[model samples]
Structure formats: C-alpha cells, structure tokens
Target: MTFSIVGRSDDGKAVGVAVASKFLGVGAAVPAALADVGAVATQSYANLAYRPQALALLGTGVSASAALAGLIAADDGPVSHRQAGIVGMTGPGATFTGADCHDWAGGAAGDGYAAQGNMLAGPSVIAGMEQTWLGSSGALPYRLLAALRAGDQAGGDRRGRQSAALLVVSPGRGYGGTSDVWVDLRVDDHVDPVAELGRLLTMHSLYFESPEPSSLIALTGPVAEEVRALLAAAGFGGEELEEELASWAGVENLEMRVVKGSIDPLVLTHLRAAG
Candidate 1:
C-alpha cells in the first residue's frame, strides 16, 4: 500500500523520509522523524502511533532493533499484515515487512537507511528499488529520490502514482536550529510528483544553504551588495541584521549566518554585495 526511504544525512546531523502511496495524504501517515531520535516509516494497515512511540523508545537510547521490538510488541496486528522501517538515533537502521503485505512488499536496512514498500507491482519491483538505493552514491536527498524513481520504473503501485514527498533536516540546519524543518515539500497528486520534488529541493538549496565558516571568502566591490540582495530575496531579515551586515562590509573572509526569516547581518551584507 506504500513505499518509503528513511535515512540520516551524510553529515549525520539530520534524519528524514520520502514516501508515497495511492492513498491520500501519504505524508501525513507514513513519515515521522525526531531531531535526535532518527526516523520511522510504518505502512500496510498503517499504524500511525508507531511513528511517535518508536521515536520515544529511540529517544531513551533504544537501538533500532529494540525500538522495533517494543513497537511490534505493543501492536496486536498479525505480522503478515504489517510492515515498517526505522532508523535509530544511534545511526544503525532496521526494517520489516510482514508475510501478507500485498504482491511484493519487502525492505532493506543499513548503517544509515531503512527502505520498505508494500502493495508493490511485484517482487522485482522491490528488488529494483533496493538495487538503485544500494547503488546510489549521492547525497541523502538524491539517493532517496533515486530509490523512489526506481520503484516507479519497476512498476510502482499497481494502482498508479499520485503523490510523493521529501524531508531532510540537520541538527541546526533547520530554521534557526529550533523547531525548524529543513526540507518539507509534498506532491499530493501531481503528474510528475518526483520531478516536482526535485525542483523544490533545488529551490531549497538556493535559499537555505550558507557557506561554512571555515570556507569563508573575501569580498570586495559589488560583492557585498550582491550578498545582501541574495539574502533579502531569500527573506532573511531582523533588527540586528544591519549591524552584522556592517561588520561584513569591512571584514573579509568572515563567516556569516544565512538563516531564513532571521537576521545575520554579516552574511546578509556579504550576500547582498556579492550579487
């Protein structure tokens, strides 16, 4: 009935999931992630509670295997009809697919990822999804996207493709670092859901990614104004922003914060001038 990929970012500071289903609003039911506890994907006769309960266990130092046991033990559902995957905060991952999950439902778990699917077109479909994911050598977001595409190419849901979603977050990469969601986009019923997701991700990178302090670049002339324009266009502003920008106008190679909807005057000035 569903398909999903759950994993931590390469840097290990973030955890996220991408999932889709013929079912409506698959994002609301299949994906869940805690800033520190990892992620969960519970499908089939979907158990929404497993999302939070599993995270709660992972929160208390539970390994992915233990957290899964606790969740399964709590559920009375017969194993044949249930399917799920979990990536624990410790970074190890785990997943399970019941005997009765439609035609070709199954999964693979690894050091940093959990992949699962049910009601697939066939066994080969799941295999292709797994192969592409394993063979992928790219960013977490890209790998997850490729896995989804492989599944679709393999036959996808016998019912057809309707919606898809992508979400990735790092320790402080989220908005201002607290209660922030780094990437949260969904396509409920698009003709090209995956392609649309890729587009959104590209936009996200442009607006949110900031240069690391260690790689600070010296700026002069129109560079400062360009940087400010970029930041402003991305919607970052605040009372103290001007002060930070002023400092950057004089200092070269100073690291600047580029938070959306927040002020980081130094980065703002650099960005504005760079443009």
Candidate 2:
C-alpha cells in the first residue's frame, strides 16, 4: 500500500509527485511524471505500463480521466486489482481504486493534484493524505512530503514502511527544452523510509526553490558595507567579486540564482554525509 501527492507548482513551471509505501522499491513502482504534461502514481498490485502510456496520452492533450479511461479500456484486467491517480497538464485530476484491491484502498483527485493508496490501515490513510495536501502552503515538494507524512500518521501500510520516492519535471531545463525533468528522488529500501524521505525533501527544496523578486531585498547606502562583509565570509571574494555578485544581487534569500550551477551540489554534499 502507498500514499502520495501529485500537483503543479504555483508559477506553473513545474509538476510532480511524492510517495511512500510499505513495499519493495516503491520508487520504481509508484511514481511518474513528464515535463509540463502531467504526473501519475500507480500502486498496490500495480501495472507499470500505466506510466508511459498515460504520459503519452497526456502529451497529446488528453485529460487525466480520459487517459486513465483509455488505459482501463485497453487493458483486459483493469478491474482485477490496483489503484492509480492522474493529474493532467491543464490541472484536472482523477483517481481510481479497484473493487478488488486490499483493505483500506481508494484515492482523491482534483484541479492540479491527485493522490492514491491501497492496502492501507483504513480509509483515514487516504483522508489524511488529502488533508495534508489541502493543508500544505509552500512549494510543490513540501506539499507532497506533507501528504505522505499525513498518511503515515493516519496509519499507512499496515505492514510498515520500506520505501519512498518523489518525482518532478518541468519544461526546457537545459537540453531538450521541450520536456526537461527537474527533480526525481527515491528511497528504495530503508528501515524508516518516510524519515529518509523528509531529509531528502529538505535537501531537494534548496535546489529547486525559485528566485525571490528584487523589491524584497533592496538594501542600499551604508547597509551595502555590511552586506559585502557577509558575502565575503560566506564564500565570495572581496569587493570585486562582491560587485560581480551584486549584478545578480539579493543572493541572500534567492540563493539558487547565485550558487554554483544549481543549489543541488551543496545539498547533496550534506545529505550524502548525513545518510
């Protein structure tokens, strides 16, 4: 069984999902996303084909419900067992839990989001997942993690935790420019997968958080001296490098824009050591 969150970012540049389960390699089994198209999670006696085929359908302007319906119609055993959720590019979402699934199985879907789980402790698992998604107020990854945590708190897999994962994608990162994935994380096997997932989520946020607007960090006049000293201590060189850094400016709150390449390197260093 599993619980998850799939949703779009506020600025709409990103879409993704995060999930955790008491199953082996849940990462490999439960989550999928395509840049700017949509995201899906299939769990509990999953049929992995649901991922790529659904993404293909989503890319062609099909709605989440339609894509899922197509899958069910095409499959000979659609009703035998399993659960799934889909979120389309236009923000519509839908979910299905087969009648043959194990105890405490079902799902929730809505605009810009979807979540699903089967073989859970009770209906509260799905309800807590939905509440966590509705309750979260920050970035996409945080919301997803919150939902997973909520599901766990509400009695997740009656079997206990073993694996977790998060998948995210967005358009034109650097290469293809049409469909560039931004984030994908997984905890394949762990004694406490959700705990590992939270640590990973904290590290993931530093890399993907957007730049803050200039109006919020316009310190000028004498305050510039203090800013220079702080930057120097933090890693930037003296006034010349500070002047160069000033071109991007407001590096404090908007750390992503100023960090090397992207924010992932430093976060990874810390995480690797922690794990």
lDDT of 2 by residue, 72-176 (tens): 777666555868888877866888888988887888887778878878888898888887787777767777778888888888888898998988787765222
| Model 2 worst lDDT run, 10 consecutive residues | 260-269
lDDT of each: 0.73, 0.73
Best by TM-score: 2
* Candidate 2 accuracy as TM-score: 0.77
Number of colliding residue pairs in each model: 25, 0
Give one digit per residue, the lDDT tens place, for model 1 in 1-275. 88888887666767888887777677778888878778888899988899999889998997888898888888976767888888865666889888888877788888878888888887666677678877877566777778887877777777877788887655666654565477777887777676777787776654455554554444434654555555455454333444555444334433224333343444544455665
